[model samples]
Target chain A: MRLLLVEDELEMAAALGAALGRYDMILDHAPTLDHAMAALANHVHDGIILDRQLPDGDGLSLIPRVRALKSGIPVIVLTARGAVDERVRGLDMGADDYLAKPFAVEELLARIRALMRRSPDIAPITARIGNLVFDFDGRQASVNGRILDLPRRELLVLEALARRQGRTVQRSTLEESVYGYDDEIQSNSLDAHVSRLRRKLSETGAGVEIHSIRGVGYLLRPSL
Target chain B: MRLLLVEDELEMAAALGAALGRYDMILDHAPTLDHAMAALANHVHDGIILDRQLPDGDGLSLIPRVRALKSGIPVIVLTARGAVDERVRGLDMGADDYLAKPFAVEELLARIRALMRRSPDIAPITARIGNLVFDFDGRQASVNGRILDLPRRELLVLEALARRQGRTVQRSTLEESVYGYDDEIQSNSLDAHVSRLRRKLSETGAGVEIHSIRGVGYLLRPSL
Candidate 1:
């Protein structure tokens, strides 16, 4: 996932950036509220990590602007202050989740996945084509109640296609959802993922196929 | 909104119950985790306010059960412990929002409203028919950019019908949404609210009509 980290603390930001890289997430750091808003204006990040305390202004102040855009981008507020009122205020202003300082990076990763699952336009609840079921929340696919143990990237590729089932999901859109913004896309990496996903689905009697629309994108359809 | 308040504190529960009543929200108080679970098993609540330090177990633990039901019932964790880790843990466990103790009742109300807006099946985003727009998030209706200042119950009645748009929303469902669970139905109260709403829409040139389905419910459709 591509995320913008609006944190003033250089050390925390750098540490988090490296940690999230292991999970294939790219982080763009914004040192101040102004920079955060500017970054948001230029590019769309899948999610945002906002520090309540920023150099220019309070992070809670950014929630209104983010919500005004109505893109439903999930925002996780980070604060050293773990006061109950502060958490309530952040959520009321539109932060999807909240994390206090001194948190484990694993927790952050888990929260991000949870937020992505609830995102309407991003991850659909589940998609069914014929007998195959792609459950976005579980990050798994199953055929007739039998699970398919596909790798992480493969599952992501399926999720992108499943969300747009019966229609083509552009190659660029699939890559954006599967890989972080700054990740160097190995020429055939997407094809590799889709190929493996297709094989796994067939092996499980999924009754579905991933059809490539030459030079365009990929579509998920029921097999004859 | 119909809510379940799972807090052991009788005084706080009573205060919040009364406050929410003023806004036409019904509160079902469950003083313990067991009671909360039992209440949930028997009846449905639009949302829940959970106290983390429950008598039997941690409030966060209940989130799994709530989510397991796949009802999409929003859970807001309330706690006196202001520790940062606790807040993150609550959210990671699936609490929709978190509130520390000593919070303003108004903040809780705002968070509840926010959660209701995100709930797809419960409260839809915005329903648009011709020039009329029912903005659920703002809890307001506008026509040609001009806002119609609708009363609380009137707005709720409009929201219930607008969500189903072309189809009729049953009278029972509309009553459940507009009035509290125990609020006495004054025979034609719903009709009164709908009448006012319909007239307001016409007065504002909102090209739509609320059609009463005889003895059934109400449907909103574009006016000829």
Candidate 2:
């Protein structure tokens, strides 16, 4: 997940950026509301962690603007003020969650998770194609109750395909989901992983086939 | 997840730290094999990201030591050498995964996820208590297919309780899971969240009850 953290304090931002990265969530830092607005305009984010105290104005003010720019994007207000009224005010102003300063990183993570859960776009916990059952949450795949022990890249490739089974998943989308932004994309890496995944699935009698859509993307479906 | 990253390059360590933090993964940096050993002895980590070239010795040499120290701990070797032979050598030496330098962080994360999923300790994707069903990965709870709209903190409290329904979850464990490592725990905060959660559950007719075990912790079970 990609998140925008609107925090001015460099140390705090660094600390938070490090914490959230470990969970595989990408974070973009905006030191002020103006920067935050620019970031929001340029990039799509799964959620926003807004610091109430900003150089330009209260972070709470950004909630309505965020709602205007992207309706229903989750926002969590972060402030040093732990007052109940401040939290209520932030909530009333369109914040989905309110977290006080000196909070635990775990608590912040939990809040983010909770908010993301409420999103309408969340995929089901599991998906199936033929005899293959993939547990999206557990990151495991099994066929006939036996787990398929696959290499990481292969599994990731399968995951991208499995999530959109029977539908053509564009190559760029698969690459984006499987590779980091900084990764130097190898033109053939995805293909190699997909080929290996296909071999493993067939060997395991997963009863699934992956069809490449000539220069476009790949699709997974039940084997005829 | 807490990870031990044994990398000699200062910039590389800093970049990885920042990147991994965004995902909510805690990284502990070790500049040398000695420091890495010390960290492993002192703290339990979910995995290790090993850099092949270290000041003290070749990182591959440390794999056996790591395995001896903590069996079943996943290790991923990062090296400038991407040769197939070198990759094989690293795997033979006990590295669970090997990534050539310039690899995407997303690939590393995927490898970690795949390895963790193979562990027996992974929890089910969802848990149930009476009418309340909690989706662990999605971080949402529902009562008989009706999603519960909850404030973040209250949901977190309920999550900690619900995961181990019918059993006592220690206060420290609940606090640790709910709060961050740096959070200053308020004596009454847990109580406040639990009380609010109880009220909300009752209002929603969740058919579950949270029981406090005095000084011990809390438990969730079907409401009689």
Candidate 3:
């Protein structure tokens, strides 16, 4: 899961980022409300962890801005104020959950997961197309109940395609999903992965087809 | 799935809403940027279908606000400004996908689904606690792969608790999940559901246990 954390303190942001990373979450740190807003404009996240007291403005104010875009994204407000009224006020202002200062990372992770589970728009954990099933969390794909022993890169390619089954995923989007922001890519690396994935799907007798959209990217469609 | 649609045109919103609803999506309409922002601050949405020409301002202005909150939430900008440069600019400014006016509702639905599937933070579709498995999409639970026949309300209660797995889910959150926003819940309705669910879990030899925290909410943890 990707998260945008609006916290001013450098040490806290680093610490929180490290902790959240262990749980397989990518966190982008925003030191101020303006920075947070800038980050939000560029990327998408599953959740936001906001610090009530930021260098630029009160984090509570950012909540309304977030609500304006997608009210369903969970916002966990972090504050040193442990007063019951403050907590109540935060909730009243639309924070999904809260955390007092010096909170345990484990508790924070638990709360984040709880908020995510309750999020109505969260896509299903697994996706099934034709006779093929993909367990995204496990990074495994199965056809007709038989697991396909796919290599890591092939699985990532398959994930990018399967996630948007029956639709064309742009070439850049697939590259971003498969390779990290800093990862180097050869011209034909993505094509190689897609070709191998295509062959594997056919060899397994999986009732799914991966079609390359000429110069665009690739699409996964159920076999006719 | 839920979506926030920011469009000033009433007829188009209604037509699009009806078409998207057939695919099991709930569309919340916002006539202006103010309304869209207000809606975003309150409810959650899987995606945002934005119109570049709004009564209040350019819908492009709202993209950053949404990105601020949940960067992962897909934004598909819809407008009559079909100029090639306009589309590229919208995407450059953080819109995930763009569609021009006079588009087919079928195409819109397909685009929306593709965006939802591409979302990275969509929580896992299925969750497991010990030998008990809960499929959020199917709204069913199984023990040792055996389907547990649970009533609607009971299943909802179980879902609220199981989503958190070992953590305690607050009472208010659980109520909102099980009942509608306008549901006039009785004092003991939740309690009744929990009682029945507990009995059913024990009777079915389910591996998970639901523990109620006094004055708080319920939690589902593996049976010790």
Candidate 4:
């Protein structure tokens, strides 16, 4: 798999790294973005096409700084046809895929193997229950032993109810998961954000309940 | 946008639904896959183009049953030639894009406009951070306001870190978002699953924190 082309037009990045290195892959080329962040701080590249014009910089400000330092590293973006607002600001700067500029080097190797096959179904960045942990790509969190603060929309609603741990969600699905359904929500805002996330889990006891099924919604039962 | 052309033939699904409704886009046509899951339970298509020789089923087991019920709906298989290992096992059966068989309808309208341009950067899948909440195609999650059972590999590592909300994820970039360097991982065990996800986020008190920079990897700060 491994890839990371970048492109500064050295004959179209050597005809797209010898036509995507004859499809077996393991090609790293980079022509800038400071040699693509010094070959992304030395090796490791399953996907990354980049390019929105770069001899030195401005690849949509390195897509939210390579999604704030490799969040799932698929990227793609290439852009051109009238920039068109760098294809909606390069997928709001996280870029999982995109390719414009008179494309088709076999459609940029089929959109970099469809963003390296929809990024391997996400492995270990960690998220556990019972003992309580949410390494969320190492933003760090500890419970039993101690240490916590959890602000960011209460850790994105506890990683969206631990990514569907027991399931339930609704209060219009937590006001459409942080107001996206085209915002304007109110009506007791997902029950005042689940009553301040159940008083911060009973002020750190962490029994983990977050129940409420009234009109039918909410649920994150760790032990009750 | 608005697509859902499952396919059971009948003249190449009426000439690819009249050239994808003259590219303005909008095609509900189905023929099987139980009329494409009863038109995906009465309409919801922004991307979906199956047909991996589906007479009755095997459209790559409907990509984890449509991402276990909508994790940003983007499916595209359409195989038939040498089937390059059924296009890498239908891209590890999550098929977020693939189109083989004598392709070209303008390469299937640039792979359906690159799968309806990656849902306008995590579209109306309700999202937010700093109190975190991610509806992500209704997979669901919530935090500061409670709800957190989390486990399917920690909800795909909190849906790739709550849809990249204020990102920063390394550790071999979250193991290629899940072992795609050519599979074979069995275990780094991702640092003991990030130390059992920091003890299950303080036993669900959900205050949050998953930081770890030691050698560079992980971050779910939620603005702490």
Candidate 5:
């Protein structure tokens, strides 16, 4: 998952970015409303963590623009403004959720997940293909009840492919899922990840295979 | 599309970044081999543009690591090393294409597109759904043989939905296709774009409808 964090504090942004990265969530940091606007113009995000106070203007003011650009995007206002009116005002301004300063990272993570669960495009929490079972919520994959420990990138690639099991997942689609703008890519990066993933799945008796569709993408299906 | 550019010169990186942005290709700049490696570890890219000289070491040396990370990712070495032996060495080092420094930006763009065409994950150049015809290569859509003008974002969303016409495209998948890591997303942005696209298509009499699958995503299918 990718998120836009509009926080002015560099430390906070860094902390959040690192914390979110553990869950394989990529973050695009916008230290100001202007920066945030530029980002919004260029990219689409699953959620936004907005700070009420920013260098250019109040983050709350940006909410309307955000709404104009993306009608139902979840925006959680994170700010030092903790009073009842402030919280209520933030909500009234269209912030879906609000949290005060010095919030627990765990709480933020839970809130993000909660927002995702309520998202209109939420996928099935769990999916099965052949003997392979995937827990989308937990970001875990297993074969016949044996958990398959895979690297973060490999897991992302697997998640994307497994979601569309029988269907071909385009290479571009996989690349978007596995890499963020911060990462550098070569044409073969996705191929390399898939090759590595295929070998691992086979060795683990996944009962599934990732098949390449030349000049197309890849299909994950029962290995019969 | 996303690419990694390994160049030590700030001016060169900035110039390339701006030039590539025009084509909607995101460029992740790495000033050194170490930075490039970090990026490689984190992201999967469609291609790489490597400069032979860098602060940390020769960019050619990074080719082996790139191969290890993503076996067949197309790599184009752009450098001042225009000697016959240097060009030959770059290709030997697994650079798919080599260009000397001071080459035309248009030429670089051409090479990138050419490499994409030959990539295993290349999608069809065009597709048809109902009366709507899409030229994936030219990035244009039409109905009744008349081009349907669309904003870049709308076109991207349309391309993704049209590519999987009659099928449910996960919101995450669509998000990946429309937004890059640099964009800030609110949960509703995709909906807004889809909604706008729907309105435009209806107004244009495209004879196709984008259906929301509720908790899944959107599907593009022929209108009744």
Candidate 6:
């Protein structure tokens, strides 16, 4: 996918550019809002990574301009710490999503993919993989339209994994997202959840695998 | 609207605490992430103001912990400049909203309102006043479930009022949220929008009065 990253900081900009590039996606870096606006005027980008504060001015001013021009192009605002008004205003201004600064490259990639997919429209309430359908808000999983009663923790775990379908999610991220921050997770708790879930899927003959990435994380993909 | 302020900085924390106290809400202050977690475990708070950079650890880790303990408690992360990752990670970790450092107390108060009204499972998307119901996401006013389509600006203006329900949404906040940042709104655009939407609402035979606060914003109240 083509991306435009609008950021002023040199080192962070270069690092983000390189990280996205590693995913085999083309990234165009715009150092200022003017450059970003010009890039918007010139190119067709599948996605955008916008920094809330720029050298010349506050980036919020440019949000409506991009929306006016690109209309539905996915724009993800990168906000500095504790800028709540900026985050809400950005969303109200038609940004598809908002990301805070001092973020990890992997988290950035995850948010990018999620926003890019939803920018064109609201994501379907249910996402289907193989024969399994997951209802996001309802937090239920079904196989061939049959509701599969799943545990809350497993469901949260599954939702985290499915958001990154076909891509790996790090163990730490999963632990933090699915479990409360201070929960003392047993060494094999995540593995145990995955094992139980895998068994359940296999029982229903759903041809999907929660593949282990070993030391990194796990991925949910159709059985190969 | 009781709040918990979890921040490490002594002076800034005290200032924010006093500012929030003036709003007549309880302000529980904690200096570290662990202490903050303990505070949450002890009592329920309607809203939380968390500093991302706490002495003990990163504040992003506390969101889920707090949320699990008190569902629908609006958390506004207090982020320092240049910490994009912390902001994004906080949101992805289920923070209801974020606020950057160096923000106005008024803006923070406004955000607190927005977040409180929109917290998951707390506020209904559709609000009924007399016979009229406002659908925020759909941006429409309904009379007994019959849709009343409104123009974008007017719809937003109506929502701004409806969010307050029986109370008033400050005009400044209404203007900011509707037109967004960089809106050089001249004339009585806000009032004009409110007038038109109010007329439309009355036309549907829903006896809902949009009371003008005169120099403030508008209020939505059921008319007998």
Best by TM-score: 5
- List TM-score (chain A only) for every prediction: 0.57, 0.70, 0.75, 0.23, 0.84, 0.53
lDDT of 5 by residue, A1-224 (tens): 67899988899889988998898887888998999999888765778999987889899999999999987688999866448888898999999999888899899989987776455343444455666777665677877667789988889899888766555666776776677655658778778888899998999887898877554567787787
Give one digit per residue, the lDDT tens place, for model 1 in A97-165. 676678878767877776675543343567889788776654556677555556568867888888899
Positional deviation of A119 in candidate 6, in angstroms? Answer: 23
Q: Which docking class does model 1 fall in?
A: incorrect
Query: Per TM-score, what order, best first?
Result: 5, 1, 3, 2, 6, 4
**What is the C-alpha lDDT profile of model 3 across A1-224, one tens digit per residue?**
56788887899888987786555556788888898887777666679998888777789999999999877789998867568888898999999999998899999988887776445354443556666877543446777657788876787788777766655577887776565433458788888888888898998888898866554456687777
Q: Is candidate 5 or candidate 6 better by TM-score?
A: 5
**Model 6 Cα shift for residue B165 (angstroms):** 18
CAPRI class of candidate 4:
incorrect
Per-residue lDDT tens digits of candidate 4, residues B49-80?
88876788777777787787777787888888
Give residue A168's lDDT in candidate 3 (0 to 100). Answer: 57
Instruction: Kindly list the per-residue Cα lDDT of model 6 for residues B33-87, writing each as its tens digit.
Output: 8888888888878888888778988887887787677765677787775575665
Off by over 4 Å in 2: A9-14, A28-44, A54-57, A120-122, A136-142, A145-163, A179-204, B1-224
Better of 4 and 6 by DockQ: 4
Q: Which stretches of candidate 1 lie over 4 Å from their true place?
A: A1-224, B18-46, B53-58, B83-89, B109-124
Candidate 5, which segments miss by more than 4 Å at Cα? A41-44, A164-167, B1-224
Q: Please name the candidate that would achieve the greatest DockQ relative to the true structure.
A: 4
The digit string of per-residue lDDT tens for model 6 on A15-48 reads 8767865554557778898898877776556678
lDDT (0-100) at residue B28 of candidate 2?
A: 97
Kindly list the per-residue Cα lDDT of model 2 for residues A41-106, writing each as its tens digit: 876677999998899988888988998988868899886655888889998998998888889999
lDDT of 3 by residue, B1-224 (tens): 89999999899899988988888889999999999999999998889999988888899999889988876687888756438557655655666666668787866776776666554333248788877878775456778755565666887888888788899999999999989999878788889888888888888888778887999988899899
Structural similarity to truth (TM-score) of each candidate: 0.47, 0.41, 0.44, 0.27, 0.48, 0.33
Point out the higher-scoring one by TM-score: 2 or 5: 5
| Better DockQ candidate (1, 4) | 4
